[model samples]
Target: MIRHCVFIRFRPEVGEAEKAMIFTEIAALKERLPGFLAAHVGANVSPETGMDKGYAEGFIVDFADAKARDTYLDDADHRRTGAKIVAAAEGGVQGVLVYDLEIPD
Candidate 1:
């Protein structure tokens, strides 16, 4: 399985409702795209200081494998959603971080 993690720091003016809408849109991708196993989205609630690096929200999407992950990256819907995120995020693309990990047997 491949775990695709995304962290975001929204622009200061972005409201909770807008963020929620973004999350919902992202979650909806599971039904539209193949190879999307599951997803989880939420705000960062960590108590540790200076660790979050201004990223206050994030999500994790699980895929069946790297091929599925690659497919997701290339999907037009996913690209559109990503563009929304970048537009809302502080510093544009700089406000987001993505990390993909492959689970071993």
Candidate 2:
């Protein structure tokens, strides 16, 4: 299994409504993409202070395998959604962090 984690530092001006819209768009991808197992998204809720380093929100996508993950990377809809995230980020793409973790079955 592949765990695709995305942490975002949204611009201060971006409001909750817009953030919800972006997350909703992300959640909607399960219906369109193959092997997209699950998606978990929300704001950082850590008790520790300053640990988020401005990345106060994020999402995780679970894929059946790397092939599915790669396909998602190439999907046009994903590309469009990615663009929305970049646009809302603090420094374009710099405000986003992507980490992929491989889990044994």
Number of the top lDDT candidate: 2
The number of the candidate with the highest TM-score is 2
Count clashing pairs, candidate 2: 0
Give the alpha carbon lDDT tens digit for every residue of 1-105 in model 1.
Answer: 999999999999999998998899888989977889999999888999779999989899999999889989998888998999999999999999999999985
TM-scores across all candidates? 0.95, 0.97
For each of the candidates, the C-alpha root-mean-square deviation to the true structure, in angstroms, is 0.9, 0.7
TM-score of 2: 0.97
Q: What is the per-residue lDDT of model 2 for residues 1-105, given as tens digits with 9 covering 90 to 100?
A: 999999999999999999998888888889989999999999999999998999999899999999999999999888898999999999999999999999999
In order, candidate lDDTs are 0.92, 0.95
